[model samples]
Target: MASTIRVGVVGCGFYAQNHLNSWHELRREGADLTAVCDVDPAKAEAAGGNFGVPHYTDAAKMLDAEKLDVVDIVTRHETHRPLAELAIGKGVAAIVQKPFATTWDDCVAIVDAADKAGIWLAVHENFRFQTPMRHVKRVIDSGAIGRPTWARINFRTGYDIYKTQPYFYNEERLAIADVGIHVIDLARFFLGEVAHISCETQRRNPKVRAEETATMMLRHESDAVSVVECTYGARKLPDPFPETLLEIEGETGAIVVGIGLRMSVTSNGQVSEESIGSPLRSWTSEPWHASQEGAFNACQHFLDCLKRGVPADTSGEDNLKTFALVDAAYKAAEEKRAVEPENWRRKA
Candidate 1:
């Protein structure tokens, strides 16, 4: 990988706008936006025109034509495996957007393919990279909260998400699979790996086809416990629509992220509080800036790893652990019992 990283983007849907803008903004930092591809010609053209790059409807054509160091696949879950496999075939690193894929087998296939090729593959799990979330992790790492023992993480909101993603209205695995995965991932981020997980789900929104609310509990390997909650049907005034409110307790003290991204930490007989909100950027807006900024940070991490010849924190292998929690949550809800997360092993 060179300091001047040549990059190609493979999806141009709703969320890909942020990816395009982030990559464009990173131009000063050495990310050369080489080309973009989408099956929809209009979308491909729009993205390419807007970003001033070549566009293609076929992914294979774009990959064959460009000398890209990385191909950022921002497509939906169902397309992740195939696009990843294609990129692996071309020997290009990929940053896949999460929900890793539609199923555990699909995610495993992508990871396995990348592993076999020895390619740098990562899932775009951006929540943990959010400014406020990073601040929380920083505090924890600084030992301000000592050894984390328990946590309650929630991403409850009634925002009209369907307006932007009407396709989600019919997803078979709505809450837990769609948005709860981020909250669940955050739980794993704050605590350690899960020993086992239990969950209860509900179809709170009559209009939705699947469960829109999920309440999960996890027992961490380190004896820490976490209660994780996610929903798209919460009714609240001035809703914390895109904010993740959490409370983490450790051996020495605790950390809490309340409404408005205000964080409070009580550490070793001392207390401090501040607003740990997302940083404003030219491409960011209210309510969505946290997520937008997180995408930028996640991309930066991937780019830096490519240049440094290292693996990402959210590498394909590591994210399998997070995706396993998702599978475990669904199983727990269905079986009405606590379920251990399924672990993956590389073929010898």
Candidate 2:
């Protein structure tokens, strides 16, 4: 194994810039960002110029030309399967951004391809890596919250997200598929695997083409229950646009995370207050630091995992659990019944 990992990043759009910045920052940590690619020439050129790396307009071309150990697929969900398959065919490890793909079948296809080829694959599921969420998980792991029984995970905001990604306005599946997926993953992170899920969807924004809000209830395999909520149509003061807030109650204690990244914990009749927030980075800004820092942390995790020859925390197979909840939530809303999430049956 090489001491330095060579990386090629596809999709240099709005969010991929964070991935670029992160990889560039990790050069000191043994990441060699050797190449970048985007269908748009301008995006490719800009990213290349910014990061001082070769850029290509075609992902296949970039993969063929670069001596890359990994390819980061930061493209749209619809592009994930093909990009991942391309990387896997070339024997390069892949890290895809979430929704994973447009549907469960597509997500599974990509995972299947990776598995058959024995290529390392992971989804850039960053929410759980955010500072506040990490803090909450640490507290839970320390047994301060003592087996979480009930919880609510929410990411609601009225901020115009369409400003950066205008395509969000026309997605056939918006809320749960876009932002809610992260919150649902958080619910599973705090509790455990879901036994079933029921959901309600709302198209509160009259101008939007799809449901802009979703409220999902998950019954964990452990019998614990969680209410997962997300929306882009919220009208509120000081909206936590990019923040996830939740309340987790266990047998012995509870953890409540509120606005401003403030967390309150009650363990064994004792209470404590904590401000758990991500530190702003040179390439990160306020209101989005948590998300930006999370992207960085997630990339770092992928690099470390690749170096150690270990499956990522959010490996492709593992992310299917999170993506399954997404598919089930949409189905449960449409069918007006609880739906069991479809699990991946690995090929033997």
Candidate 3:
């Protein structure tokens, strides 16, 4: 209950830089980034030097030493559960990045621990927070698109994503778990909770160990059916890398978020179009700005929710639903059938 929330970031690797920058920018909004930690000494030192904060190579040492109100776990999926548990165990709140954990049990354990500790827990699911997606949600909520019926949410790219994070080549669960999870969450955000899901997965890229492409069909609880597609192996002329193009049809109207972030909506027989691209912040760059803006917006949302003492939109419990789709999608593809996403709370 300090005037300013003191934050300690656990990872300082590639994507962690965005979290560090976002925390620094949130200082005016009452975020005090106190410390940074990474197993790699060089990464830790560089982030600390750039951000003017103390650095540590050990997360336990940093967690023990820093009087942090919240710990942001920006590490890989494998480390998420333990890192989150570590922070929650010490009575500090936690915000972990996507793909909550490697498995459903791990995700459940972290949630259970946080619930018992009575601390805030959220997953940084950024897609729903992106500017364009937010606008799409607003249009749906405004009744501009009355009762979204059928939709296609897609994230396809031929961009060389492995250039930055080459470890993707070795991941056993690649496409669906990596980028598809975001689109899947977006589907749930705009539409509603899915009643059942059927998916098809392919290992299109010979270089990768697992499926690099995933196409899922969802039957929402609203009786709406949606097709969600995501792949890193798309080969096309207008490669919309890192952009999620969508088409949503409602009872009265429709919305289409096309390439270059152009959003067209037809409501009540009136058609309108606008460029709803993510604005570039001082600390952000082109192309990646869309995703970086999402990360920043998501962090801001989490910080605000923490201050209000409320569960975030992507709270551990809610994200478990999204995570469940990930598990069900993989199973659906393997079994060649439609599967109902397991309600984690019911199983708990």
Winner by lDDT between candidate 3 and candidate 1: 3
lDDT of each: 0.92, 0.92, 0.94
Please write out the lDDT profile of model 3 over residues 1-348, one tens digit for every residue: 445889999999989989999999999988899999999999999999999999999988998888999999999999999899999999999999999999998999999999999989999999999999999999999999799999999999999999999999999999999999999999999999999999999999999999999999999999999999999999996888778999999999999999999999999999999999999989999778999999999989988888778899999999999999999999999999999996654754
Best by lDDT: 3
Model 3 CA deviation exceeding 4 Å by range: 345-348
Estimate the TM-score for candidate 2.
0.98
Alpha carbon RMSD to native, model 2:
1.2
> How displaced is residue 313 in candidate 1, in Å?
0.6
Candidate 3 TM-score, true structure as reference: 0.98
Summarize candidate 1's per-residue lDDT along 1-348 as a digit string, tens digits.
Answer: 568888999999999998999889988888899999999999999999999999999999999999998999999898999999999999999999989999989998888899889999999999999989999999999998899999999999999999999998889999998888998889888898888999999998889999999999999989999999999999997899899999999999999999999999999989999999999899899889889999999988887888888999999888898898999999999999999885643341
lDDT of candidate 3 at residue 185, scale 0 to 100 = 99
- For residues 251-275, write the lDDT of model 2, one tens digit per residue: 9999999999899999998999989
RMSD in Å for all candidates = 1.2, 1.2, 1.1
Instruction: Return the TM-score for each candidate structure.
Output: 0.98, 0.98, 0.98
